[model samples]
Target: MTPEGKALLNIVILGFGFMFMFTAFQTCGNIEQTVIKSLNNFTASGYTSMSIIYGVFSASNLVAPSVVAVVGPQLSMFFGGLLYSAYIGMFIQPRVWSFYTASVLVGFGAAVLWTAQGNVLAINSTGTTIGRNSGIFWALLQFSLFFGNLYIYLAWHGHDHISEKDRQTVFISLTVISLIGCFLFFLIRKPDTSEPIPSETAEGLQAESTESISGSGTPRRSLCTQALDAFVKACKLSVTKEMLLLGLPIAYTGLELTFYSGVYGTCIGAMTRFGHDAKGLIGISGILIGVGEILGGGLFGILNRCSHLGRNPVVLLGLLIHYLAYYLIFLNIAPDAPQAPEEGTDLQAYITPNVGVALFCSFLLGLGDSCFNTQLLSIVGFLFKEDSAPAFAVFKFIQSIMAAVAFSYSNVLQLPWQLLLLVVTGFLGTMSFFVAEWKVEARRRDSAYDSI
Candidate 1:
């Protein structure tokens, strides 16, 4: 098969694999705070588990590139998928010790899985197609949100509490779907690296080749040495000028990711006014969020194909939408609603609960997320074409740390405080991205002139 054909095929595989795996993971996550609390009578256990996952994920990224180097991207991804499957399986029984343990393991798995995914994607895509490829992959993967949440709405819509039988059935099915995704990872074939990279990608990177990470002609070395070198490279990359500038934006994405993924849904489910209808509302929110994400992914992917369009516009759009979402969340969701449910002393919000408005916020959040994430991926792929692995590792490392911090504080801070932080972070992140982008463009123009 042609290289282009293989690239497209692999992207599809990644999309479908993640769609199935996350379909289970995301749905479970959406209900985690409520379901786990109901099962064990522990109030913040779900948030704690999520915090643990991102905490470990942050640490694991330090070594993920090295692991990918030794094991290869395909094998590394397969191992990571296996870990995710294990985490979901633990839910079938739902023990505190086992649940937390699985969360830790899944954290490690997530780092390697996402890092390897970046490696494979960078290898297959050219400068021209990178945005399109990332878009396709994101759009397909977001489908999990649709299917998984739809199932929840169908099965558990009106119920306030999930039964033991229902819990077992849901988890068992999710585990099976995740396992199928794991198998799909094993089927991926890495693209041939012997062919010359296209001029569009090679223009400013003439001195550095795509094979730099392929380890094509390098002599055999100890796995320990390779890992150490990769770790050092990731550390060094983190402090580089471009990365330093881009850090805030990358970290902001992580913060917002936590909010939309788990926090907001919990708030929707916990509001006393919603009563028994909360579960159904959460499902509807999830479905709309998916729709918004899919639309943004496809739209940005097409826009990215036009060279003059750049990425800053998309970033600005995301910033504005997210601010709007936060405003709605502040006005409608009580500051204490997410953590305490009906138990909190504070129940009054600026606006009375309205299901339609809440769902609108969810959709806007998803769309804004797609805009930030797709642009971030494209920027990394374009700027760090040669050292994609270590670059991606650095991105995840910082992003996960921020995500961990966000989750940890989710239990302590009120919704108002959290919205304030997000707004500030979003502004800073977007400005940082603009500066980094300008610097990259200036450097590229200088290089072009030098060549002439």
Candidate 2:
């Protein structure tokens, strides 16, 4: 194909890939709600069964990155999607093992989808453009999640009084979506091949190019070499006495991941505790989050342009808002209080001021969380190189580990304490931005001195 044709094909493939990947992501997000509803109706255990499902999925995130590296991104996604489809299908049978197995498959698929999507974004863009592209990609992915929940809600609503046949229908529909996602993988064009040049050759080319750009000036390395050098520089950025200050941001990133994942789940639980029906509250929260995400997408460029405080400060602010949102939710739930009686037992006793507070908290949670996530991506773009897919992948791997921890802990912990844990997690997450900032500053200083 001609170069223009190839470029067009590349763009088309990337767009379709983004859409499919986002769809896959939405499917993953919808699973918890689906499983919870299905299990509640099918078994007596109800919410307890849902917790087990969360644990299985959480564990899967811990292992997903390595699995993706081994399988290649495309195949990883395909396998994940196909397996996830089968897992959802198994829910038709409604055994304990089926739920467990399905949760694992869903987790595995989500991991692959996230990793592959990042890789695809990396392959398609460069420089600052990479960050912008990634932000847009992620924002849309979040939107897809909103729609996924809506789709599932509609499906459930249509079969409101779900008989065995209706349940089977839901499973079959999910399976179809998963399989379609898998098939969509074939459309993703392979990334361009640019073999890594040796450091010496890269330096030489950079020097020559620098000389050409600046007549009578000393030669400097090429952009590619500069980027590789930056990566090496980032690795050597240090975590010692002087560098300890910079390591703060990396640490904060971890904390944020823990807080966000954990608190969101806890908020949903809190809502349920406050007499809001699980179905209604989850759907509302999803809608609020979707709206927040749209707002975040619109604010991306504006936030990126604000250089006075820089990306790190913006991220910190976002995290602070998120922290407050979670705190509000926690306060509303009164975690230490005794569990309210079941639905039929004095329903009026359960309905009170606490319920209103919880609903508001859910809305805030969506808004604050979306802002923080958006800023976090922008910060990653500013701090890392264009081809920082591997770095970003590693970052996500760490985030997933933290998320898994939070998810698991939510299942095991009580209400008030879980909120406390989330707060601590968010604080730690906020600290990661500082670490990243320090590293960036140190690199700037080092680069300046190296030139001297």
Candidate 3:
């Protein structure tokens, strides 16, 4: 195939697949950030439910590397996405057991899909173009949030309260979209990678190829064994001072996601002040976030292409943006803002949501979020280019676990403290990059000595 065909295929296949899949999952899952909350209203803590999902997502790191190692990105994404479709189906019945079980399935799939997607982006694009490609991926993937929000707005725009049936319909719609996304994933051909990462060894590729078509000669390892080995290597790597420091920020990414997409949407956007128009406002928040992501991601690419600032600066900028956004949220709502549906009932009767302020926060959250995530993607994919799967898995594992922690505390914590924690996490994350200057300097010195 021509270079153009390969690039086109990547964009069409992965791009649409990511967009539609998230559209189905995040839409029904995220709207007003209340899906899990509503489901857990009678039986459990919403944050606990969400934490189960994220914890499962983190644990996927154990098995995802081996899966990708054997089957390659194309099949990994397809199968992982198939699992995602199944998880979405479980939402039809929102029982605790169902939520937790589905969470595990989706989490495992998320690890594979995300790990493959990142490696795919790195392998497919040139070093010069990687940032731009990453930006494109992020910007397009976020469009799902906008589309999902719009569907919510159109369907339940004027209702003061949505019926369980209406909610079921929402889940059903999302499930159909997710199923379509799984199909798109299958259309993605195995990449003929130009700049394959180190983990994509020629020997491994040959083994996979031979095994696929002919059988025999491919050494087999049990999934448990593969996962264990990957886990051990990644854990050793993860504990380095630099990695631990970097982890501080990656952890924040999860926390930020839960805040923006989880209960905050329901607490601040849905019940605060919009009244019957709350659903529409929630959808609007998604649109603003989507638009902001487009601008932020596109700008990241442009800056990478046009300037020498590289990625670290973008991380710094994202941190500041988040700080400012959180400040706005705190000013409008109480520092002790409760994110639980049960706790929010009183606030629903009384709390004032500063629409202008809160919506602005949403925009910044998306913008800043894109900046942090996109840059992180570029940096990690480049840094761990050789051991891509394990490295990416560890990084995501950090992100998922941290997010799980944050989500677990969502019900107990106040907004002010949560935002403060975010600031701390962002600082640590950014500081991690800054500390890497030493590593870069050491490498340069070693290279210089070798040349001499």
Candidate 4:
């Protein structure tokens, strides 16, 4: 198969794989209420799950590049997919042990999957196609968010509590979907032609224009040694000026996700802190997020193809969308503040973020999100195409840490404070990337000269 064909297939398979897991994650956002039904918890169940999940996930990046180096991208993803299914399987067991263990597995799996994905997409794409491919990938992945939320609306809309039957059914179904994602891994074509890239200077440039995941040559070392060497090399690369320029934006991916998926729903979706059930509303919001992602992805994808309207412009437009959504979301934060409201009545029903307005906010949030995520990945894939594994591993690591931090503070921080933080930090994140774009332009010029 042609490199482009393989790249397209991998992207599609990954989108399909993500659809199930994203849905599974979104379905029971607050597992304490839905699955565990814990009454004595201080932290929100959403935080509990995200912290556990991303905590482990972040830690695993230390080894992801090496793992990808040793096993190759396709097999790495296959293993990751297999482990990812365990997360959904946790729904069936619902035991504390099952939950935490699955969280670890899923976290490690996510690191592996993301590392492989970045490497795969980066390896196959050229400067010309990177932005479009990344956008397309993000667009396809949103189907999971859209359809998952749709499933929740269809199956559990009216009910406050999710039954074992409902949980189990969704679990079983998405589990199969995840397994299918793994199956697609087998279809990916690994490059058996490239020699060890002893020095990826000329070879790296050639590799980028061709099909090679490890742009650096593979040394004949033991698995542990290979991974250890990769880790050290990757770490050195991570601290370089070029890579550090991207830190803020990469970290923002985590914060954005945590807020959109976790905090926003908890704070604004309900009619009151404890009044109307927000599950249905949040589910609907997920659909809007998916809507925004697809639209943004599509727009960026198109613009990326045109030299006149490439990545930077779309990302700038995303900043506008993000700020707009921020104000829209602000409208939903009731002055009365959030209470556990698990059992009590909502005091300020009038101000609940559960109307068309909230939906609009959600749509904007999703739309805005597409710009950062798709573009960041594309930038990393293109700029560090030769070192895609390490660069992406670093990206994933920061992303996980930011997510964990967001979740940890989500409950303790006041609604106003959280929103304030997101606003300030999100702006910083985007601007950081904007600055990094200049560096990328310089690098691209260098690459063009080298190719010449």
- Best by the lDDT measure: 1
- List the global CA lDDT of all models: 0.80, 0.50, 0.69, 0.67
Best by TM-score: 1
lDDT of 2 by residue, 1-452 (tens): 65334433554554555455445444434344334443454442222433343344434544454454445566766776676666566666777666665665666566556655544444444443444554555554566556555655565442323356755765666666656757777776654433222222111122233233223353355445544553454344332332343233443444444433333433343333434354334444555656765675567557667565655666666666666766665555544221221221122222343645555655555555655556655555445443334334434544555555544554446556755655675666567656666676778789999999
Question: For model 1, how does the per-residue alpha-carbon lDDT over 1-452 read when each residue is reduced to its tens digit?
Answer: 88788877887898888888899889878877767755755433778889899999989876776677667777888899999999889878877788889999999999888867766776767766766777687777888998888887777767767788877887888899989988998777766534443533321111122243455644356556656776787788889888998899999998998999888988887776766777667777889999988889878877988658578999999999999999988998878866764332237589887777899999999999999988898888678877766787778778888988888889889999999999999999999999887877787899999999
Q: Which candidate, 3 or 4, would have the higher lDDT against the true structure?
A: 3
- Candidates 1 and 2: which is better by TM-score? 1
Give the lowest summed-lDDT range of ten residues in model 1.
Answer: 201-210
The residue ranges of model 3 lying beyond 4 angstroms of the native Cα positions read 1-7, 36-41, 68-76, 116-136, 190-229, 309-312, 334-337, 340-352, 438-452
After superposition, candidate 2 runs with Cα above 4 Å error: 1-34, 37-73, 105-115, 126-132, 155-167, 190-278, 334-360, 374-390, 435-439, 442-452
Model 4: CA > 4 A from native: 1-15, 26-44, 68-75, 117-137, 183-222, 272-277, 307-313, 335-354, 381-386, 438-452
**Can you give the TM-score per candidate against the true fold?**
0.87, 0.68, 0.84, 0.78
Model 4 lDDT-worst window of ten: 197-206
| lDDT comparing candidate 3 with the true structure | 0.69
* Off by more than 4 A, model 1: 1-11, 41-44, 69-75, 118-135, 186-219, 307-309, 341-346, 444-452
lDDT of 3 by residue, 1-452 (tens): 87746865676668888999998777655552455544445465556766877898887666665677667777778788887777677667666676667677777888778767765665556555554565577667878988888887787776665568877898788888988887886676544545433333211222233233222345465555656766787778787665665676677788898888775566554353545666557777777877878889778867977876566788889988998987777766655445545223434222356677778888998899988887776666556666655666677778888879988888688777887888777787778776664465566579899999
Give the backbone clash total of model 2: 17
